[model samples]
Target: MLPSVTFLAKFSPAHRRTITASAIHLTPWQPSSPQAEHASLSMMADKCKSMDQLKQIHAQMIVTSRIHDTFAASRLLNFCALSASGDLNYALKLLEHTPMPNLFMWNTVIIAQASSSSPFEGLLLYADMRRRGVVPGKHTFPFVLKACSNMKSVRCCEQVHAHVFKFGLDSDLHVVSGLVRGYSVSGGIGDARRVFDELGNRNLSIWTTMICGCAQNDSAEEAIRLFDGMIADGFEPNEVILCSVLSACAQSACLVLGEQIHEYIEEKGMELDVILGTALVNMLLRTDHWLKQNSAFMD
Candidate 1:
């Protein structure tokens, strides 16, 4: 009988590896009907709550000559690369083995790597994809752009921005938003503002991106200005935007503005999320201290 998942979890890391290797070696299989084959493989993929189970299932795929099946491979890749429980190295190895991976496979890997701790891998994958002459789709650019944002790679970001324009994805909201965020995170606040201004009708996310970007890059005054403009334009502040403006208020020690924002939060019935709550508390404390010192000097 196959060892249960609970049993595998109890094993030491070294013991788990040995068990995985043994399971792969002992498992024998013949090609079943196509539908049945995919069903079985997919079932295994979905039930992969641990890395060991994934390895054994992958070994089964190799033995059954189903490794080349893009659907099956993609499912396995999704578990290993994208899911929090899986390993990026294993996913990369799987992709390397596939002979001339199609667009779906390439995009899947890029998307997974972009959101991983090592976002630079996604940027590298984009370059590799271009070298391989793989045509990028709309879905492709956002993932790459997000990687740019995470890496704060303004140079790569500008190059990707040009690519977005070249591919006529300049009008895509997701692509534009990614570019705005990328530029902002890279300390290119002017470039981010340029992107924002170019948009004919700005959404709340676009406003929030610019505001938060300013706040993050130590341009708290600019963040406040953007927040005021966001309100003037009639956009209701969400928790994210509120936290950002509140942060700016705290940094600049703008007590009146902070109090106004606190009132806005109460009037709007917005929840005080941890970030917002912290920002508000800090602002109140700082403002109180400033007032007390000024009064003491007068006395």
Candidate 2:
């Protein structure tokens, strides 16, 4: 129901003039007061209800010579790019107008788009950044890799994987985890495994991604094997890891293993929230069904 960027742009000329006319109102402000300036912008950004409001504020900032204020711009862009009050299109428009967007701006937009319904836009933004000769930071790869994961685009993921190595982020925990997830979703489990094997001090997220990826991609037995290795390697399983292992148990009809997991949950006092509860309950139901079918056959 919010206005689109194109729709909002139609009124920019009028809004710009209105802001320019009121430029004298902001003359009392001093650039020496960075904290006060940030506070004022933050409060205004927090109160913004629509793209028009944001554009109006942006216009005012321009007239007040605060156009290049990174903090103010970040707050505004974060609202536009990530919050419900704004649109991705508007966020993109804002970025397009920025004379030189910093890495934080790029990362924010990339993350917002990747997490949006149309995730492919994040990849396009990444391409745009590359064409502009912007060097991607450590935070940049994970979000774009997430876009690759969401689209299940193996070719795109492969290109990003190469970029990871090129940028010397191959060993970065979050980047490697993203690569593992991207490969897993793209049905390149072998590549995912290769990346997993190369990790020296594997974290819970990396292990969870590989296990969940295997469970979802028809490698349930491998998931179980990895779960065992995770425990043996001293990584305590979280609810997410347990849920994935439970799913693998359900797929394999391994009642013994499922029961062990249930006992482990009790031992660890892990909360059985909706997701983990559903996984455990489904595992139990599937195991019982398999047992009944087997017993029926024997009878």
C-alpha RMSD of each candidate structure in angstroms: 7.7, 6.2
In order of appearance, the predictions have TM-scores of: 0.80, 0.82
* Clash totals in order: 0, 0
- Which candidate wins on TM-score? 2
- As for candidate 1, its clashing pairs are none
Q: After superposing candidate 1 on the true structure, give the runs of residues whose Cα lies further than 4 Å from its correct spot.
A: 1-32, 289-299
Write model 2 residue lDDT over 56-157, tens digit each, in one string.
677656654465776677777888898887877777777887888888889999999888888899999999999999999889999999999889898999
Cα deviation of 171 in candidate 2 (Å)? 0.5
User: What lDDT is reached at residue 53 by model 1?
Assistant: 78
Please, what are the lDDT tens digits per residue for candidate 1 over residues 33-131?
767866777677876887877878775566445677887888888888878898878888878887777787788889888888889999899889899
Deviation in Å, model 1, residue 299 alpha carbon: 33
After superposition on all CA atoms, how large is the RMSD of candidate 2? 6.2
TM-score of 1: 0.80
